[model samples]
Target: MNRTARLYALVEELRAAAPRPLTVARLAARFEVATRTVQRDLQALMAAGLPVRAATGRGGGWSIDPRTTLPPVRFTAQEAAALTVALAATDHGAPYAAAARTAAQKLAAVLPAATAATARDLAHRAAVEHALATGTVLRLHYADAAGRSSERLVEPAGLLTAGGHWYLIAWCRTRRAGRGFRLDRITGADPTPEPAGPHDLAALLRGSAAAGARPPAALAALDELTAPGELDEHRTTGT
Candidate 1:
């Protein structure tokens, strides 16, 4: 297993064996690694803010503080499969793609052996296509409020979906400002290899909201399209 996976497994093992320490020798044997390697892993975990305590005396080894640990998360096999498949449906080229895959793997690892297999198979069968334009920099043929078409170069900062419609939050090169574009209004999108510049999405949104300024054409359209109180409900539920 990779070091990341090993670290996760180590934490779980330690949590399960809490109150009674697991000696270095026993942990090393369990993971099939050298005793020194186990020590280093424990050190690394401690450095990363895990409350790992080590004792030198007999009948004492290493243990994590139960009070500092999160409660166990339980998901049925079907729920795990459903969540994994939903994550797979996200845009393939989005920044979170790798993270989503890793998260699914971690979830599977924590599940029962048989259930893990079923969840993986179910996740594999679901797919999403043409979900988002590829790359950080894109050339987009966009329509305005008056139905006037224009081409612009934009650096995609983030993607958000509300009320069943997707919006691309981007830094517009033509306007030299941040804007939100409705995916359906984009007539054409050509991705470039250029890297997108840094953008603070939260700050941008907060600033716009504070100013009570008119939003970009796409966002204005989205506000009109969505049902009343939908955005409020999204915020309340934290979905």
Candidate 2:
């Protein structure tokens, strides 16, 4: 499990065992992680404002404060359906797909039967097409701006939709850099058994934004070729 989900599961486990301490060793065994990792996860939970209490001596463990009570979480059927549909939009082959599916199931299990049925139906109808699954290693047949084509092995970082087009941001092994490819220009993609490495997603988005702020070469050339008076006239006339 990922850290976020593990932290949540830890909290639920502690909540279930409230007033009774669960030892670090027990938590480690339960989660199949190192004892030190459980300690770090507890610390993170504490930092996030969870009322987690720790005891250090023999027979001592962690517990949530019994006096603290949380209100029941409530969601409307429409809201539940929307959330399920959103999860269904994730790439089927992505690393997060299993997690997303598990979460959807958990959500359905918590809701009313009728609402759960509606959510399942809505999720079934939603799909994300022609996109590389996130966190997958892909071999792509890519066509570039000048109509040149090349094959590249890339680790998909994420997907973006802008101006009615979809793009894949990936760490390209061929170029040894992060690159964005239009989905339409990628003629083919096949998943590789090798897992993808982590990416600096924020930096990639920033670079994409910066690149987008500049006009295309043809537009720039047009601007340069136009006389000042003609440009002013065109703007004034709304042409």
Candidate 3:
């Protein structure tokens, strides 16, 4: 297991083993990392709404509420393909490299026939144009270009491939913003639970562009492909 997956596994294990709240030192001992690293991990977990708590003083550590439920894990073939492409695009030897490759293997094992074929064709024909993917969960202490210091507990939503680059759209708690954060700028990320509130564009904008207006030429061509099945829904949704 890579560092990213190891951290995730550790969190899951600790959450399972502890009867009460755990301290930074205890968690550090469990992972054999510095106290500072455990503290940072705790912040990311808390932001991700893991029901984590921290007490001050010598006895302080991290603790998750026993009542809290684990997050769900499900993905469609297209979603899996997107993730595979995104992972392949990351720096050649990132910390999550081994885990991501393994995930892509698992995705291939589970994909439906037609969907898998489409993904294979796409993967073979198109290269990962940008290398990004900082980590599974960000380190929680980095500042953005705007000089804003922020921490986020983000669920890896679907990966998007557009104009030859990959983007991760997730539910971010710290900014309370469902924003498309560039994977490359991410200093580090760890797998975590999805936050309660999701960022939905339809819900956020509330009809910003004005319906029935003729779309630009680029979007006009999408109508031809809306013959039947789920494709029709995509057209109806103004995709």
Pick the TM-score winner. 1
- Write one digit per residue (lDDT tens) for candidate 3, span 34-122: 88877776776566455677767765556666666454357776797777556534443467766665556545545667776666545
> What is the C-alpha local distance difference test score of each model?
0.61, 0.62, 0.47
List where candidate 1 sits over 4 angstroms from the true fold.
Answer: 74-217, 220-239
Clashes of each: 0, 0, 10
> TM-score per candidate, in order?
0.35, 0.34, 0.33
lDDT value, residue 58 of candidate 3: 67
- Residue 4 CA displacement from its true place in model 1, Å: 4.0
lDDT of 1 by residue, 102-171 (tens): 5665566556677766655444323211222333566777765457688887777555564564456667
Clash pairs for candidate 3: 22-61, 22-62, 23-61, 136-189, 136-190, 137-188, 137-189, 137-190, 138-188, 138-189
| List of clashing residue pairs for candidate 1 | none
lDDT of 3 at 181: 44
Off by over 4 Å in 3: 57-59, 71-239
lDDT of 2 by residue, 126-168 (tens): 3312223335577777676556778878776655544455556
- The whole-model C-alpha lDDT of candidate 1 against the native structure comes to 0.61
Score residue 140 of candidate 1 by CA lDDT: 71
- Reference-based TM-score, model 2: 0.34
